[model samples]
Structures are given as structure tokens and as C-alpha cells.
Target: MVVSTRAGAERSQNITVVRQAPPMSRTVSAAGLGAVGGMVTEYLFDPELGRSRRARLRDKGVRLTHGVRNGTRTVVRDVRNRGQGVLGAARYRTTGREADDEVLHERVRAELGRHVRHPREVDVRVESGHVTLTGDVLDRESRRAHRAVARIPGVAGVDASWTTHHDARRAPRSREDGGPMEALQDLFRQRWSPAGRSLTGLAAAVVWSLSGRLPRPLGYLVRAGCAVLAARAATNLPLRRLTGIGAGRDAIDVGDSISVAAPAEEVWPVLSDYGLFARWMPDVLDVRRSDDGGRSQWRVSGPAGVPIRFEAVETAREEGRRIAWKTTEGQLVAHSGELSVTPEDAGRSRIQVRLTYNPAFGAVGHAVAKIFGADPGRKFAKDLMRLKSLIETRRAPVGAGAGPRE
Candidate 1:
């Protein structure tokens, strides 16, 4: 007779088989035992939860042939189609010593683009992951370029010694960042311009008159104010190109947009993961979140590995849509940025990031920052590309075990 028995929702169930026949008889008469088992065995099965195939086996049970169990290992395997063996081994090989020439070339090109003003002018040749950079480039660019190439994941070595900086290849002198004096001169020259020269003259006359009429202390303040305003106005005017200064502007603005073949939900988690930002963002040495997790501080390496530190807070956010941040405190550089995610048809998303920052020392600091690939626009674009590659490819995290596949 069947005793009390019940099954869980799991496709498989715990079962107990009680032995009554003699052990000798059971061993010697397999066919006879099978005949008796067919008439005595009972199963308790539940169909509501058929997702799992594992079950526990217990003792202390009688059998009745009235019920059925529908669990099977093959069914679960078919549903998920999981793979076995070295997980991510192929990906690891592709990113390391076993990387092919094409992979190495791509990495080299991307790196060169970030540091060199004219990447197309450089000749990049990669064989067995050894890189040879040959082209006419600036002296400073050549040094920076070689160092950057050496740091790529698969580059065995860099050969750029033959690279020369010719006068012809040298950017025009006008493209150089004139010092503070030159910037002041550019603003003074604008006093004769047709558009705003009248207003400029009027403002100067007002400042001069006010300075004489005001008391000594207030007069000094008026003159100082006039000087500061005049300097700012000059820096804003279109002046000769300053070497290393982008767009002749004191502040840097960078923007980029990319299409990712993943849903917004899938991309948001990776974007908000501040700890891993350093992994995809170049030059970031370390990043930490505050105790409340609302603020983040970043330690970054600048040219020649000089340390630059900054703290930022998330200013605004929308779930699965966008995030905006600004530096609350920093050394050498101050920055603000935003990232937006938009859903398109299918399971694709368009992701965009924009960043703007000004150096603490103005034009000089801006020029020095370019030496380290610290340009906000250039950094933004490269970081976005890295992010795109990581998310779309779904590669395993850097140090995950090969035994388990996620």
C-alpha cells in the first residue's frame, strides 16, 4: 500500500524505497525483482514547478503504482543549453599574448589616436604583437606616442626611435597657446573691431571715470575689476591657435555618441559601477565611493604618471536613462559631465556622454594636460568606445574563474 507522500513544486522529488525482499533473492533474481518492483513502486510528483531536475532520495516509504514522476535531467539541459569546459579562455587568449596581428593593430591605432594629433600621418605596423610606429610627428608627440603604444594590452614592444619631428610636420606657431601676455594683447587688439569696439571703448571710459571719482580704496577696486574683465574678454575672442590648446578656448568640451546593441536596463548597471570606471577609462588609477555611496573620488595619473585627484557627486539621475555629475573638489582640473541613454527599436540603445572642464591654472594647465591624454573630449570618446566594446561583447570580467560561466 502507498503510505503518506507529497511532492514539492520542483520537477524532481525526494523518494524513499523500502526493501522487504531478501537481499540474496534480490541479488540473484534481478528479473524477478523487477517484476515485483513494477507492482509495488509509487511516485509523488508535482507539475506546477517543472523548472529544476534535482531531487533528494530518502528511505522509510512503501510503494503504490498509482502516481507518476515527470522530472528528467535532459529537459532541464535542453532549456538552458549550457556549455562546459574552459569558459572565456578564447577571449583571454584574444586579449593577451595569443592575440593576432589585427587585434594588436586595432589597439595600437586606438591608442595612437588618443595621444597623437595626426594619427593618420603615423605608420603603425604590428607583427606578432610587436608594434613599429614610423612617421613624421612632433618630438613631444613621438615620446608620448611610444609610451602609449607600449602600454596597450597585447603590444610586445614599441619601435618608434626612427620617428622624427620635422619643421614641416611641426604645427604652425600660431597654433601654439600664447602666454597670458599674448592673450591680453589679442583682447586689446579687439578694441578696434567693427562689431563691439564702441561698447568696448564705452566700458573702458566708464571704468576710467569711475576710478577717479571713487575713493582711493574703491578706485583701486574699480581699476582691478576693469583689468580682470578685459583679460576675460580677450581670452574669449578668437585668437591665434595656441599649441596644445584645443580650439583656442580656456575650457575644454568633449562629446561622443555610440549605439549599443543592448537594452537600457542592461547598460545602466555598468555605467553606474564607479569602481570599474577605471577599467574602461584610461589614466584612471583608482576610484572609491563614499560611505553613503552618493559621492566618488578618483585618483588619476597624468603625464609621466603624475597623480591628479578629484571628487565628484552625482548631480542628477534618471533610472535607465541618464546621469549627470560635477566635480565638487579637485586638484589641477575641474570637470562636469553627463551621460544619457535612449532606447531604440529592438533591443538596442544609443548612449552619449559629454564632458567639459577647465584647468586650475588656465591656459598653461590646459596645454600641460594635453601631454597626458587628459583632454576631456578625447578621454570622453575613448572611454565611450571602451564601454561600448565591453557591453556589446559581454566578455567575462577580468579575473572571473574559468570553471563557472555566468
Candidate 2:
């Protein structure tokens, strides 16, 4: 049985409190808590909670205790931040991104393949963003690893203390710069963009290419015009179309804002992975990107696996931060656009997507007036949630501040 005394919204409950030491309590050192939470979670208390409380937390939740050793501060800092920043850290919190990353690194490493302790050679890997430093340095080679990482291009920066162990003072040499483990992480980053073929946006577009009231060839033209107007319309988005201009290539407007716990530099690698679409952006099907050469494609899929008639091609491409694509199958519609990311204030960046697609059929064969539509507005809302998830999950060195954008 449970009993509670309550006044207003504050409630003190008399319930069976399982006063057991939490699993990570031993690793949650006082210093770790302070590093991640500024000087919090150091005090001892009764009734330590478990991660099982995930369901009960609203707005936030936490489970903390302290007894870390060695890199105690690093361990405890990550434990306090065991979930998203909103998830809370009993005494103090950030987000468990650092902890989560450690778990991930250990999990998919070799096979996947990663580092192992031995007596001959020691290999160190430091993954900051875009670049991964994988090479062999001597024992406690951490300092040497940082120096190497800083010299690598395409990398924003490296966490100085990141390194691995070995038994030999003199190793032949690392096979290449980074191994398969670093490759996997970097590979995924490349595939995460929104502008590529085989993307969810392309899939949704394919689904809708045949959806709605307007008919294509003619309808495509309508959709294209609408899409152009929507792109130019707003930076924030209300996208309430004034009239129900029939579809084909109707303009679409998607607005989003995502907050991350670290600075912009840390957040750069994560954002660099994505391009410009939600898994639900209607009409196009498969979007794939390739920097090996200057070629990218957006393939359309229909009722089943069948390919539709619409596919977009990239006419111009930049390795990082920018991409411009165009399709001139103008019989039905023509699609043209560029996605640009500009760093905003507070370690954050603003993603601006400018698109101009011509929807077939108009009074004089020219782009025309607009109307207020509501459904696309709702989808944009859902997309914002997804971006928030991706950015907040980016990992960094334990104890060091998360350079994520808040």
C-alpha cells in the first residue's frame, strides 16, 4: 500500500521506496557530476532510483549516485546524462550523449572491428566530426593521437584524451589512417543526407506523385508552382495556403528548429550527415548522393516497387554544406533547388532550402497565385521532432563539454 501527503502540485508520498544502490551509482563520481552538471549531484541521499523510471518522468527524470574511480569524473558525468538532456540526472544533468557514445563505440567496434588491449601495438581512434583518426601511437599515446587528429582535414576537432592500449613500444605502423570501425561511422554520416536518392523524402514524393486531386503531366505543373511559392514564402512557416490550387507540383514549405546541448562545432558533424527531407516528405521516392563523382539522383517509386516517370538529377554539387539539383522533364514539371546551412547564434545553424519547381497547367503557362493549405504544415511539425532526436544524440568525449548547439 502507498500513501501520500499533497498540497497544490507538490506531493510527498509514503510508498515502498526500493532504497537499493543504482547500477551506475558506483561509477557516478562527484567530479563527473560536477563536470557535466556544474556542481550538482555530489550530495549523498537515500532512495536511489533506477533507469526503470523512464515511464514516470514527464518533462524530465533522473537517477544518480557517486563512487567513481580513475576517470571517475568522466564516468559519472556520462551517467548523470544517461538520456536526453530533458531526461534529467537526479542531481544534475546534460544529455547522456557522451555515455551513449561510449556504449555505441564498444558495441559496433570490430567485426565491425575496433581496438583491443595487447602487449605489442596500441591503436587510437578519435572521432570528432567528418574525420576519424585511426592510427597507432605508443602507450598512453592519447596526447600523440590528439596531435595527429588536429592535422587531419575535414575534421572539425578531436577530443585530446581519446586513445586505446597496446603492449609493444614499437609497432610496424597502422595499416592506413582509420580502420573499418571509423569507416562505418563516417559511412553512415554520408548516407544520412536529405538530398540523396533512396531517401524517405523521395519515397513520400513518389507516393504522393499519384495522390491528391490534380492529375500529373497537368497536375505536376500545379505542384511545381505551389512548391516554388511555398519555398519563397516563409523562414518560420505558417504555410496556410490562401486557396486550394489543384496539385501537380504544388509548392511545399517545411520549417524546423532543433536544440542540442553542445556548441555548433560539435553539432556540425551530425548536421553534416543529413540533407533536406523527412522520411515523410511526399512525392519523390528514392534519393541517393555520391561525391565520388558529380552525380546524384532522385528515383521515384510507384504502387509497388515499380519506378515512376519522375527522377531528379543534381546539376551542381559541393562536397560539404551545399547541393544544387535540377530536373528538366518539364513536360509535366521542372524541379530546381539548393540546400544551404548557415551557422546561427548559440552554437546552432539555420538550414535554408530554396526550391523552385514548375507545376504544369496555368492560365497562361506561368507560375501563379497561392492558397492556404494545412496538411503539409502538420507534417512539418513531425519532421522537426526527428531533427531534434538526431542532433541531440551526437556523441563527444566524456567530461569535456558537449559542443552541441543548445
Query: Across residues 355-391, which tens digit of lDDT does each residue of candidate 2 receive?
Result: 5543323211232422322233344454445444555
So what's the TM-score on candidate 2?
Answer: 0.28
lDDT of 1 by residue, 99-202 (tens): 78998898788777777666766788887778887765676667767887787777788888445564433644212332111123324552333223334545
lDDT (CA) per prediction: 0.63, 0.41
Best by lDDT: 1
Which one wins on TM-score?
A: 1
Candidate 1: regions farther than 4 A off: 1-250, 329-332, 367-376, 396-406
lDDT of 2: 0.41
**Residue 289 CA displacement from its true place in model 2, Å:** 3.0
Clashes of 2: 66
